[model samples]
Structure formats: C-alpha cells, structure tokens
Target: MNEPLRTLPSIDRLLGHPQVQGLLAQFSREAVVDLARQVVEDARATASQGQPVPSLDTLAQRVARLAEHRWRAGPRRVINATGVVLHTNLGRAPLSADALHAMQEVALGYSDLEMDVEEGERGSRQEHVRYLLCALTGAEDALVVNNNASAVLLGLAALARGKEVIVSRGEAVEIGGGFRIPDVLRQSGATLVEVGTTNRTYLSDYENALTPNTSAILRVHRSNFRLLGFTHEPPLGDLVALGHSKGVPVLHDLGSGCLLDTAAFGLAHEPMPQESIRAGADLVFFSGDKLLGAPQAGIVVGKRSLVRMLARHPLARAVRIDKVSLAGLSATLLHYLKGEAVAKIPIWQMLSRPLEGLHQTAHKWQEAIGPRAQVRKGESTIGGGSLPGETLPTWLVALSAEGVPGGAKELARRLRSHTPPVIARIQEEQVVLDPRTVLPDEEQALLAAVRWALGA
Candidate 1:
C-alpha cells in the first residue's frame, strides 16, 4: 500500500469526527455510514494516484458535503434576474399573496376538498373552481386538469378519439418541452387532419378539410411563435361559424391563458379564453400558471355538456388538479374576478412595472454592485411559451468581465452558486440582471449575491 493510503483514515474514524458526527444527527446513521465509506474510498483512490490523502477533518467535511448533496430537498427558491417573466425552467408564474395563503391554509390542515359541507354528502374536487371559472370566462361550465397538455389530451380522448380532428397546418405546433400537437393527438387516439398552408390558413381550408368523420374543429393559437409578414389565419369566430355550419364543435387552445389585454402593456394582443367563449368556441383550453398568474394547472371552460363529457371521462380522474393547487387557483381567479389582477398578481405586477421605476432599480443595483456594474437599456421578454416574439422595454444592470477572473460566464456561474441562486443572462459578453423580473423583497439578496460574485 502507498504510504498516503496507509495514512488515510478509516470510515469508522472519519464518522467520529465532529463534522461527520453533525451529519449523523441530521441524517440517518446508515446514510452517514455509507457516505463515510464513499469518502474513504475516494481518499484511497486519490492516494493511489500519488496525491496526498486529505486530513481527518477534511475527510469528515467531504462526508458532510456528500450527505448534503444526496439528501437536501431541492427545487430551491431562486431569484429571477434573467428578465424572463414567465420563465419555464424556473417554474413559471409566482402566485399572488392570496394564492400562497390559500395553498398554505389548505396544506397546513384538512379542508373539504371533495365534500359537500352544506349538503352533508359526497362532492367533487372540480366543484371548487368550476363556478369561478364559468363566471370569469362566461362559460356555461368548466373543468381543470394537471396541466394544459393533460387538458388537451382529455378533451381529444373524450370528444374526438377514433375520429378525425381538423387542425390548421400552421397551428400544428410544438409547445415547450417537446410536447407537440400531433403527438398529443396520437396519444389520445385521434387522427389529425391538417389543412391549408403553414403561413396562411383560411376559413375555406378548414371547410375543405371537414368530413363525416370530423369530430371537432381544433383551433390552436400560435402563442409561442409568430409568422411575421404574409401571415393569414382565419379568425376564431370564423372557425366557430364554420364548425357550427358543419355541426362540429370548435375547440380553441389559447396557450398562455391571458385574462387581460396585452396591448395595454405595449405588446400584441394575446387571445383570451373569454374572447374564445364569446366567439362561440365549444371548448376553450388554457393554462393556469402563465398569464392567469396562478399555480400550474390546465383550465377548460366552455359549454356545459362538453365540459361534463370531459369531466366524466376516465382520463379526468388521472389528470385532476390536487387540493393545494386547486385552492391556489381559486384564489388567483378571485384576483381576476375582483378586477385586482394587476395589483395582486406577481406576473401582472412585473408586466405593469413602469420603465422609469425599472431604470431606478437598475441604478440602485449598480450602486450596490460597485463601479464595475453599469445601468443600460435592455428588453425583458414574456417567456415560457407565451408571446414568443414579444419583448418589453426595460433597464438592466450590466457587469462587464473586463477585470473579473474567467470572464462573463464564470461571473454568472459564481452568482448562480450563491445561496438563493441568482439567475442572470449574458449579452454581448457582459452579465446583465434585469430588475423587471426580480421581486422587490429579493433586492437585498440580489445585491449581496452580485457583490459576492464580483468579489467586492
């Protein structure tokens, strides 16, 4: 054996060290013992490779770190400095205070999640948010599932399975995470009948595609991307009219589920579920988290009979929303019903933040981050498969890597390594943090993380 290998401390000896002992208290003894063994094995390998064996204290620290990496609960809270409001990777849509409180209230104790307190009988979980959805979207009834994808699958499986569903060639899109319309239709046992050109699909194209086997006319909103110039698609009302003439139901998939007008925020108008319902869509599907500013869920609001069909389907039970998320979603819808969405919802608040106020915040961040950071004009996007080409003007705190070690990438990485990791973006070889997306309460933490990353 190498001299260093002989000097390497045994797993039992390492476990007795102060750091490893602390780990044992936090984690099970078996887990700690396993980590200790791995640490000793690593030490032995290092020694065999002609490296000096780490001291007992160092080995104990390694065990502690290994345990932390293996056992720590994750999807940790992070500060969004990336300027993307609906960031999919970071869990899109931070809920409002009321929504958070509602989730906590339900999670802390038991509630009548699926019970009729007034009637003293069995009830349904969907009843919790059904009325709120109908009142908000002007629909006769509504249903919710785990996500928009599930809602689409359920709708297709229940209404159009073993039948042809007509979709525009241009609207056959792939949403985030590789979930495509064609794939979903296939999974639901529905045949996809594509009509019209990719950039131009007229009412006639849809009519031409209609047949005796056509179960539904599916109109998917191009929420994530846009075909600039020379793009022409039939209106929702036109599609609805055509479907009615053919005695087929029109299903509108409005992917962002925007309740408010985006034009008010200086962006292109996104299709809303209410507008689709008012236009005579039989089933309008959308997401709860994106523009609705709630928990992750799929919302379907339309005719009562159609919604009931989806609810009664076998897949509905498999994809129903949970109690906690249902509670949070109910609270979020209340914000919309009360007409306080802009004031209460986090995403709306971020969207409505004034340009001047953003500039001031960027300057404040620059002040805290020292002279290396500079306030510059930049654009913040509404990401997460909503408003693909839309961007909102904002200011950014830009930090150049001229004097920093390892340049911009390294500086950004160091910021991400901080506690409550700060997510930023790099543009033109400089790390930029947009104040638009960062919550007001996270300002201090953002400043501290920037300072640490810059080694100020």
Candidate 2:
C-alpha cells in the first residue's frame, strides 16, 4: 500500500469520531456508515492520485458534512431579495399566512380529505376547493389538478383526444421550461391544427379552420411574453362567439391566473378566468401559484357539464391536488372572497407596496449594511412566467464589491450559502437586494446575512 493510502483512517475509526457520532445521532446508522465509507473511499482515491489524504479528523468531518447534506429536508425556506415576485426557481408565490396555516393544520393531523362528514360517506378531495373556486371565478363548476401543465394535459386528453384542436399560430408558444403547446397536445392524443400567422391571427382564421373533426378551440394567453407594434389576435369574446356559432367549445388557457386586475397596479392587463367565463368560454384553465398567490395547482373553471366531464376522466385522478395543497388553495381563495387578498397574500402585498415605502426600506438596509452599501433606484419584476417585461419601480440596497475578496458574485454566493439563503441580483457589478420582495419580518435576518456576506 502507498504510504499516504496506508495513513487513511478505517471506516470504523472515523465512525467513532465525535463529529460522526453527532451525525449518527441525527441520522440513521446505516446512512452515516455509508457516508463514512464514501469519505474513506474518496480519501483513498485522492492518495492513489499522488495527493495526501486528509487527516482522520478531517475525514470524519467530511462524513458529517455529507450526512448533513444528504439528510437535510429541502425546498428550504429562503429570503427573496431578488425582487422577482413569483420567482419560479425559488418556489414561486410565497403562500399567504392563511394558506400556510391551512397547510400546517392539514399536514399536522388527519384531514377529511375524501370523507363526507355531514353524510357519513366517502367523498372527493376536490370538493374542498371546487365550490370556493366556482364562487371566486363565477363558474358553474370547477376542477383542480396538480399543476397547470397537468391541467392542460388532462383537459386535452379528456376533451380533445383523437380529435382536432384549433389553436392560433401566435398562441402556440413554448413557455419557460420548454413546455410547448404542440407537445402537450400531442401528448394528450390530440392533433394540433395551427392557423394564421405568428404575429397576427384574425377571427376569420378560426372560422376557416372549422371542420367536422374539430373538437375544441384553444385560446392560450401570451402571459410570459409579448409581441409588440404589429401584433393582432382576435379577442376572447370574438373567438368564443365563433366557437359557439359552430357548436364547438372554447378552452382558454389563462396561464398566470390573475384574479385581480393588473392594470390597477400599473401593469398591463392580464387575462382573468372570470373574464373568460363571462365572455362565454366553455372552460378556462389557470395556475394557482402565479398571480393567484396560492399553492401550486392547475385550476379549471367553467360550465357544469364540461367540468363534470373533466372530473370523471381517468387523468383527473392521476393529476388530482393533494390534501395539503387543497387546504392551502382553499384558504387563499377565501382571502379573495373576503376581499383581503391585498392585505393577506404575500405577493399582492409586495406588489401593492408604495415606492416611498420601498425607498425607506432600502435606505434602512443601506444604513445597516455600512459604507459599502448605497440606496439605488431599481425595478422589481413579476417573474414566474407571468407579466413578462413588466416591472414595478422600487429601491434597492446596492453593495459595491470594491476591496471585497471575490467581487459581487462572491458576495452573492456567500449570502446564498448563509442559513436561510438570501437571493439577490447583480447589476453593474454590484450586488443589489430589492426591498420590495423581502418579507417585512425577514429584514433583520437579511441585514445580518448581508453583513456576513460583506465580511463586515
């Protein structure tokens, strides 16, 4: 054996170390043993490569770190200093307090998820949120699935399988994560018949595309992107009229699921499910998390017969929402029904924050972060594939990297590595933290994390 390899500690010896013992107390014995073996194997490989193996203490510490990393339950809580409300990568749309409480209540104990307490019979989990959805969207009925993609898949499979679904060429887009409309249609066993140009599609385009095999007319809202200047597409009501005239149902995919009017908040108007239903769309689909500010879910609201058909489909069972998410969604909808969404939902609260308040918050952060940080004007976007190119004016606490070890990128990395990771953005080589997206209660922690990242 090589001298360095011979110096490697045995797995048994490493497992007996204090740090490894700490790991064992926190995790399973089998898991810790496996990690220790992995660490020792890594050290042996390093020694074989003509590199010195770490000491026994270092090896044991490595095992502990590996165990902690492997065992820590994740999708962990993070502070969003990035100013991107509805950040898809960070688990979009921080849940409202009511929604979080509802999730906790259901997760902590047994829920009547599929039980009919009033009649002493088996029931459906969908019943919890169906009525609330209908009440909120003014639909005759409603159905929910795991997410917007699954909802689209279920709707297409149940309604248009083995038939032709007509969609505008402009609306057949690929949103974030490569979720293409044509791909989804093909997956649902439906044929996609594209009509008209990408920048302009008229009511005549739909009228000309109608055929005996036409199953449905799909209207996908361009929620994530916009075509400016020369863009023209028939309105929802026009398409609805055309569909009804030909006895074909119109299915509107309002991706962002905005319940409130965006224009009221100084943003361009985003299509709403209630407006679609009001415009005679047979069914309207939307996401629960994005602009709706709820848990991740795909919600469908429309005519009773259509919703009933969707509920009865086999795909419905496969894509049904879980009990915890259903509880959260229910509480979120109640915030809307009670007219308390602006005050209760986190995203809405962030959106409604006045510019003056944001400036004040940024100034406070700058004061706390010392001389290297300064208050600067910035913009906060409504991310998560909603309201593309729309930004809200805000103030940012910008930290310059002058004299710092590895510059702005390193500072941002250090902040992310901190406990309860802080997510910020870089602009002009400065680490910029937006006060708009950070929750009010997380201010102190954010300040501390920034201080640590700056090595103050």
Candidate 3:
C-alpha cells in the first residue's frame, strides 16, 4: 500500500473561508487567539508525542469547533416530524399568521407599550389584554404573565402564601420537563394539603381539608391523562361552592386551556376557559402558547378582586412579560373577541385541518411527482406535552425503497439533514409523510427528499 501524501494548508490561509469568518463573531479576539494557540499546541504536541499531527487545514476546523462552544444561540428551528403539532421539542405551538403579523408590526418599531395615548399619560401595560381577555373568557378581570407556570405562581403566592392550599392528590401532576406541582407550590411559599387519593378525591375530601388557615382550593386539570376504572373526582361547580362557603376562593390551573372544545370539531375535547369560569372557578390560570396557539404567556382570569390581588403580588413583577409577548397575546385575544379564534390559531388550524383536506393534500403530493412516491393516511398528534393518548386523524404519504429494504430510516435521515430540515415519521419500514404539519409549498421538497433517499 502506498503511504498517503498530505498537503497541509496554513492556519492563516484557511481562516479566509467564509464559513470560518461567519463563526468568528461567536468568540472574542482573545478567545479566538487562545483557540488558535490550542490548535498549534495540539499539532506540535502530536508531533513530539510520536503521533501523526493533523494538518493545518484540519486545525482550522478544530478552531471553528472551539468557537461554537463560546458563542451560539440556544434555540434552533426543527421540523416537527413525529406527526406532532405543537411539539414541545419544537417549541410547542406555532404562532398564527395573524399573530405573526402583529409580531412583525410591533417587533419592527416602537409602539405605545406603557403609554396611554388616549389619556396622554403613562399607562399600564395590562390594559392591552385585560379587556380582550375579560371579553373572551367572561371574567371580571385578567392578567398576562410570562408563562402558565408564572401565572400559577403569582396566583398561589398572592392568595395562599403564609396559608394552606387544599388540593386533590390526583390533580397534583408533574408534567413535561420535570415541572412538578409540589415544586411550584414550594416556590410560591404556599403549603399544599393533599386531600385524597391520587385516583379519587371527593367534594367532601376538599371540604374536610379547608379551615380558617386555608386561603384557597387549588384544582389542577388532569389534562395529560385520564383515569379509567374506579375513577371519581368532584365536579368544579361543587368544589367551588364548598370553598366559597368557607370564605376561601378556588383556583383552577388548566394546563392546556382551549379557547374551543376541539371535540366539537371532531377531535378530542379540551375544556375551554369560558366553561371553567362559568363553572364558578374563582380564578383560572392557563397557557397561552399551548392550545391557544399564541406566544408563550400565562393568562390569569377571574373575579376582579382576586386578579387585583395577583397583580399586586411582588412575584408578578418578576414573572412579567415583555412588549412582544403582550403584542402577540393581545392580538390572539382579539381573534377570540371577533369569534375568529379557531380559524386564526395555527395549532388549531393544523388540528382542525379536515381529514378530507389532508387526503387531498397527500393526493397532491402524490400527483406532484407521479409514480415517484406513495401517499397514504396516517395519524398525527397534538403534542406540547398536552395530549398524549389522543392521535388526531390525518393523511400522509408513505415513501419506501424503490428496490431496497430499510429505506425509511435512510429517508428520515435525509429529511432531517436537509437544508431547513423536514421532520417526518417512520412507520412499518416506510417513511411516513404527514400532510398535517407540512406546508403545501413544501410538498416538492418532501417528494424530492423521498425520491432522493429511495435512490430514484
């Protein structure tokens, strides 16, 4: 075998590449010089240690790797492949086109964030969403924070800190990313008094737990899971009555609070906030980013007194949202005001995309590249750690090996590695192209990826 000859380019020469310059901003001058020194040290150290030193060109690659360590944005865009819309991994629900438009308008310029234009004086940021939220949810008042967790924290801290909070053991949930109920309680300085078994908690159980020291009853939605056999939980109305009779308010934390009950549209039913309020929940906390299909925000809506108390809490300042979140959320609530919530929310649009329409989309992909692919039906998920058991009906295209086995995995890898990666599910040794999440224009790319992976 002939010994391989190597041509080593100089470090200074290799830095001239555009890619290197693109990443150099990630590191400071001193850091860049230090990274360069390491490269030289390693190359020299390998020579002295009787090892084949990597060439100077290879050394430049090493410096680039080092630069990524010092500076990189934490978030990256990924295609939601696993047939999951609102994928928690993919940053949950996507913003609606209307919401995005609002974001662009606000994000691009200075707007009256804290100014009352009509009054010609400084104003509260809360006004933007308060009336809209109240109008949509039938609440006397409303407040928007950074996320649901913060909303819950502010409510609990304001209402129950230095007091006891009675809760059903079953509703004491620990959901995605290890966000436990007990932890939120601890941080809020509210003591949790478990009332009943994890599977069953009655109205009496909550009544017995309440006392003068009890400031509130906390009801959490068991949205992620449903209990089957031997299941019994008190209705919200009954629980509210019991708490109010004892001069304590009831707070319900609805994890995936829907603006509309999706089952009405032929999907699994998610409880809406209006229903919860009408059920007499004294205060309600819900996620703005989940089923609502807006920006990441936690909305608290309830009786004006309780909302006012929450607004005064010191923790509310810490959990306050920025102008952009307020902008996006206010616009989302306006859609609700116009009775356009479902049609304007992106996550809802994907969820409510008719099966017939999905079939047509899959058929379009099939026709777009006739005979080069196979389109079929598959189920998609409403992810974001919201709905786990329920799989929404969707249509898909199944791309398999032209003449080879195990082609699905190869196709998956190719889609994931493409420019602006395409995420698709793999099932039964075939690459499943879910039309539920893919934009119509991207069908060409999807077909191209499938055919390329099939080696067509």
Candidate 4:
C-alpha cells in the first residue's frame, strides 16, 4: 500500500498559521483549537481521497455550516397539515395568543407558583386553576393533571383500585395511542366489570352488575363511535342515582373531552364536564385541550370530597402539570370566567367560524392567486378524534399546472418542502386547502404558498 500522505497539519501548526490564527481569533480559545483541528482534518481527508484539498477559506465555509447546525435550536417547529384538529402529531391544540402571553409572563423566573402572595404564606400549585375550573364547569371542586388520561388513571387508582369498575362494553375504548380502558384499569389495579353487549346495554345491566365489590359505576363515553337505532343505555342522571343507591360513586370518563355543548355549533353533543357533574356524577374527567380550548391537561371536577381524594392520590403528583401549563390554562379559563369571550378560544373560534366565512376566505385566496390556481367549496374535519362522522362544512383552494398529469403530487411535494410549509389535502386530482385550521391572518401566507407550491 502507498504510504499515507502527510498533508495533515498538527493542531499547533494549524493555529500558528497567520490565516488560521485570524479565523481562530474569531472563536473563543477552547473552541478555536477544536474548530481549527476539525477544519485541517477535513482538508487532509479530501486530499487523501485524490481530490483537490479545499482552501482555508473554503474550509472556513464548511466549518461555518457545521457550526450553524450545531447551534441551531431543535425539536424545530413544523407545519400542521395532516388535517387533524388536535393533531396529536403536530402537538395538539394551538394555545390562544393570550394564553401564550400568560405563559411567557410566568414561565421563567417564578413569581407565585405556590405562595399565597396575598397572605405571604405557602400555597398549593393546584389552587391556581381549581377555582377557574370550578367556575367554568359549575363544579363543587376541581383539580387538573398533565392530561385527561392521567386524571382518569389517578381517579381509578385513588377510588376503584382493587375494586370493580362497572362500564359498558360498547363504551370501553382505546383513545389515540392504544390506551385502552382495560389497560388503564389494569395499571390502576382496578377490576374491569364490563356489562352489556357492544351494541345494546341497558340500565338494568348496570344495576345488576353492581355488587359489594363494585367501587364505582364507571361510565366511559363512546367518543370514537355512536350507536344508531335499537340502542338502550341508562341516562347519566339515572346511572348516577343507581350508583348512589348502591352506595358507590359514579365516575364518568368523558374521553375526547368537550367543554361547550358542541350541538350549538352544529355538531354532535359531547357531554360537558359541568353537565356530567350536574347530572350527579361523583367524579368527572376530561381533557383540557380538546373542547375546553385550554392547554394539554386532564381536568377532574365533581364533588369536593372526590376532588380532594384525587388530589391526595400519590399517583396524582406523578401526573401533575407544570407551572407553565397551569398559567396558560388559568388564562384560558379566565376568558370563560368572564362569560363573554368564549368565542375567543382558538378551538371554539375555528369550530364556530361559519361556512359563509370560509367561502369568503376562499374567495379572497382565489382572488389573490386564482389566475394561477383554482378555488372550490369543500369540507374539512373536526380532526382530533372527536365527531368522527360529522364533516365540518369548509372551503378549499386547489392549484394545478397546465395539464401536468401529476400536478397535485408535484404541488404537494413542493409545498411540504417550503419553509413554514403549507399543508392541504389532495382530492379529485386537486390540491385542497382546508380553511378549518387556517387562521385569518395566515391567509396571505397561504396564498403565497399556493403560488410557490405551483412555481407560479
């Protein structure tokens, strides 16, 4: 074998060179040596490969690229395009600007995270959002955790572990990430007492299933599906009464938690936590991010005794939310506390944005770049996993080339590649822009994306 060419300079020699020394001076002493060595090694490696070795300036450029990458912040932001509102992949539920502002105010350099500033005494972090949740949901007491699933888990662990939790077979579900009811119960040390058939469960079925071993009448909402005709289940109020009569608490897991009566927004009815409490549920658990338009949290609200029990659970601390989440959630709840700014919640705003308004927005988008694209009336979805069958009325803008056979693919690929990329759907051979998740101010950038996506 040929002897290895000795073009590589020692770290001392490289830094001693006048040109290298100039570049070294730009960096701190420790970093300068390391950066200088990397540059010289890269140059030698190229020469050994029979390629013309790069000059010091070119090496500097290469080093600059590596340095830039090293310093760049990560877990970088991505455009949400999958059309799932509460798109878990893209970090579900974008917080309102006010919520973001509130988080910024308290996220760094703590203020009163757990201190009664008014009394100058230590307070509980849970106290921050307790009153807000109770006020919003009309509950006797409330507590929040990192997520609704955590709230459910803690509740089960605290109340029903080692005892039976009676639920409808049809209502047992695995939400999002393969988190099944049975799995959760097993982990919580609770026994699963599944009652009734998947399609038909009755009040009597629930009543007969209750025994001395039953700790709670657990009613899990069939969030992912709905039963049509010939379905019979006990009303929530009746179930609550039955559980009370049996001397057991009634626990309802309103999974895919919704706060507002979605029916008013032209969607199916999702049981509100407050409604569950009002209907006499001893404990109610739901997600804060879903319909509440709050930060990612699992809110538990019901009788004060149950709430206290949940808060005292050892597992509750493990699933507890951070101070930032509490601050953001508090700000969001404050909007609801005022009782007038419910419309300001981002999720509610997106849900209640009228079809006419979407069409108008589409028209504006089309007007800006319609000559190079197309606009069509289409429907978006209430993604996240709620309202599976209901297709929200929406508007779409499509763009195509001059008879390019795979224009949709070409446009989609380019849009996904763009900085601050655009996400849309491909339907009937056209790229469709759904306005459901697109903010009003983002319309201009969206229009620009259509143009860029098509290379127009």
For candidate 1, give the lDDT of residue 257: 81
Kindly report which residue pairs in candidate 3 clash with one another: 81-423
Ranking by TM-score: 2, 1, 3, 4
Using all chains and alpha carbons, the TM-scores for the candidates as numbered come to: 0.95, 0.97, 0.88, 0.84
lDDT of each: 0.92, 0.91, 0.79, 0.78
**What TM-score does candidate 2 reach?**
0.97
Please tell me which model should have the higher lDDT, number 1 or number 2.
1
**Tens digits of lDDT, candidate 1, 35-136:** 888889988887898888899989988887788778878889999999999999999999999999999999999999999999999899988899999888
Q: Model 2: runs farther than 4 Å from truth? A: none
- Model 3 lDDT per residue over 359-394, tens place: 888887777656756776678877775755788778
* Model 4: per-residue Cα lDDT over 197-289, one tens digit each: 988899999989888899998888877676788788889999998989878999999877766678988887877788888899998988877
Tell me how many clashing residue pairs each candidate has: 0, 0, 1, 2
Measured by lDDT, the strongest candidate is 1
Clashing pairs in 2: none
| Best model per TM-score | 2
Q: Which portions of model 4 miss their true places by more than 4 Å?
A: 1-84, 401-406
Pairs that collide, model 1 = none
